[model samples]
Target: MTRKQLDTDIVIAGGGLAGATLALALTRAIPALRITVVEAFPLTPDASADTYQPSYDARSTALAWGSRLMFEELDLWGALARHATPIRHIHVSDRGRFGATRLAASDHDQDALGYVVDNRWLGLCLMSALVACPQVTWRAPAQVRGVTNNVRGVAVQVASGEHVTELQAQCVVIADGGRSGLREQLGFRVDSSSYGQHALIANVSTSCDHGFTAYERFTDAGPMALLPHGSGDRAGHDSALVWTLTDDALERILAVTDEERCQQLQQRFGWRLGRFTRIGQCHHYPLTLTTVNEVVRPGIALIGNAAHTLHPVAGQGFNLALRGIMALVEQLQQAQVRGEHLGSLQILRHYQENHRRDCQSTVRFSDSLIQIFGLDIPAMKLARDAGLVGLDLLPGAKRWFARSAMGLGGRRPRFGAVTQEVMDD
Candidate 1:
């Protein structure tokens, strides 16, 4: 109905974690930049809080030590702390097998290993932070129709009802979603492969306290994880269930009623968490591996799920996006000091230069983990169990693996107080 145009240092497409975070980071890194973010869907803003935060949602995220350090610097962890659950310990094992490994907070000499949080809480916190930053002019409830790249910078067109207008900036970042129509339109092709699995997520009740332990069990069909949610009135009501299964098996599970579903889960899961009274409303996600080659093209840079969407098997999809966002911010800051435009090829290339290796490694690692672990061969089972035992046999190796999983083992941001050498590969 109404057409409008604006200007800023950076134009971000999509308001998910990556876009929102990059906008806020750039605003803080470069004062008075006036970042504009175009979001396709309209969302309600909770303006009452001193800090922007939304109510916790049913979908949860696993926050690593590295992610926490970044959030702390952005001043988001404090708001999230109120409702977050610490992952005090992790137990990894094969179903009906003798091979198992346990990692604890005491071993790491930290307060906790990581955290399990509602996705909405983190998104709200990031949104709230963006609103508080005077340098950022938040724009959402708008859709992106076209984009252009030139020497001046990358220009993005936003559609509002019958009218379409453009916003030009030094750089344009695309983070819309996995099925990023905008990304495709930019002539960026993403390599995608199916995992042949679907994940069913829901809040569930168990028989006993989870004691802050997270479970990763490999079954003949797939891997299942029982993560902790905050406690509630019902017995074992504090756990969130993330079950991954083959496509056909998942379809059958979805076809059943809630009662039957709970009965089936109780049989396989046993009474580990206590008696499974019932499962919550179930949601299904078709798992796939997607990666957009060339994160930087023309005046556009792809981030988050738009760049790469991995199987949720390891729960590091968002973590990887956040890490990449941090890498981009650092590179941008370096470019400015060199008197180069933030949107210049040199600056954007610097980002692609530094991150291409790490991004590919992470994506490949996630896909391989799902495939390798999903195989149910008798010999493969022995090998996997042996691998778990081998790691445990060496305390040092086990700790290293734990740190890597927490996103803290490698070269960390200075705020994380980790040395650069560790992550420099």
Candidate 2:
């Protein structure tokens, strides 16, 4: 019945990619802020150990330019860049259609559109940086029993090892994931809708080099994305596959052998990447768009998948989450400077309001792409084809689309001089 009590300025639930990244950013922004990150999965001493690490489990993520800037501010990009493959160009096309679009980095006056890094490598880099910070405490392989919002702050019950500890913090940020148990325990309601499709992800090889070109090919079933990656996999595969398919089609695809799967994929994807030679183990995730109606409570806030999860058609899910974190940091910096309560309703509400527009737009953009491009109607097909052609033909339109895809459009949180000054101090 007796438990130890610990107090801190902030408690971040989930030390996955989002949580770890946010923790690093927070320390960089406010070096004096006390923080503790609780992760359900243990940090394996060896990344290659035959064990589970949630952040490292996924295939890969395309880091948008905006995300790159944020990492640069946190001084984590240099390490990340060593393992990242720059996406110099983006090729988008409609299967069996004549219309296509090519977005080159030069067109947008950039050296590269984005970078793709394996999830495992990214996790290692973030965790390594996190452990070096003396201001943060990391509790791994821990279980959160419950959460209670109190008049002054938030109280969390965490069971690590043999003892239960009550962690009291002025603020709690949930970045656990889409199916966050803590979010549910906190009585937050999520509006969720399935896409009736599943994404089959794996590391695959091509006959020829990818040339650091990312491909977005739309087929009858759904969108198939191929992102380039540096050497990592056992077979020396240089690309990550995200092939979306309908429920019926996914069943067939998942049932086939690896060779058969490769053959089928080549048939649908065409000769853009030559032949599909080698493939790693395939993983399937049912696609769904879920968002919490309210991302902020008096003492708690939601970031990453805990706040909203979107379709990967546009590869905006993680990028959107990073943007929201940047916005939240902006608000928190002001609060800290003004000596205001970080867990106050006013501070939480400000973050929610500042992030709402970007979250809604990114989700809508991804969802619309799924609906509009997946249409089988002849008229809809023609319109979609025209849209692609128009985007390629018009310089202004192409530039705008490229910017959005690069995560450069709209209002972005300042992560330059201000961030540097914080690091310097």
lDDT of 1 by residue, 5-118 (tens): 337777788888788888877766656466788887776765433553433237888887778888776667897787678887888887777787888878888877778877
Residue 111 shift from truth in candidate 1, angstroms: 1.0
* lDDT of each residue in 1-425, candidate 2, tens digit only: 11133378888899999999889989988888889899999877665312433332357899998789888988999888766778888999999998899999887678789888778878888877877799898889986677788866888888898989998878889989989998998789999999988998988888988877889999987899999866422223368889998889989988889899999999999998888987787888999999987999888999999999988888888899999998888888877776777888899898999889888888888899888998899999999999999999998999888988999877887543345454344
- Every candidate's CA RMSD: 4.6, 4.3
Candidate 1 residue 321 C-alpha distance from true site, Å = 0.5
TM-score: model 2 vs. ground truth = 0.92
Per-candidate Cα lDDT values, in order, are 0.76, 0.84
Query: Model 2: number of clashes?
Result: 0
Off by over 4 Å in 2: 1-6, 46-58, 231-237, 415-425
Model 1 clash pairs? 52-128, 205-236, 206-236, 207-273, 207-274, 411-423
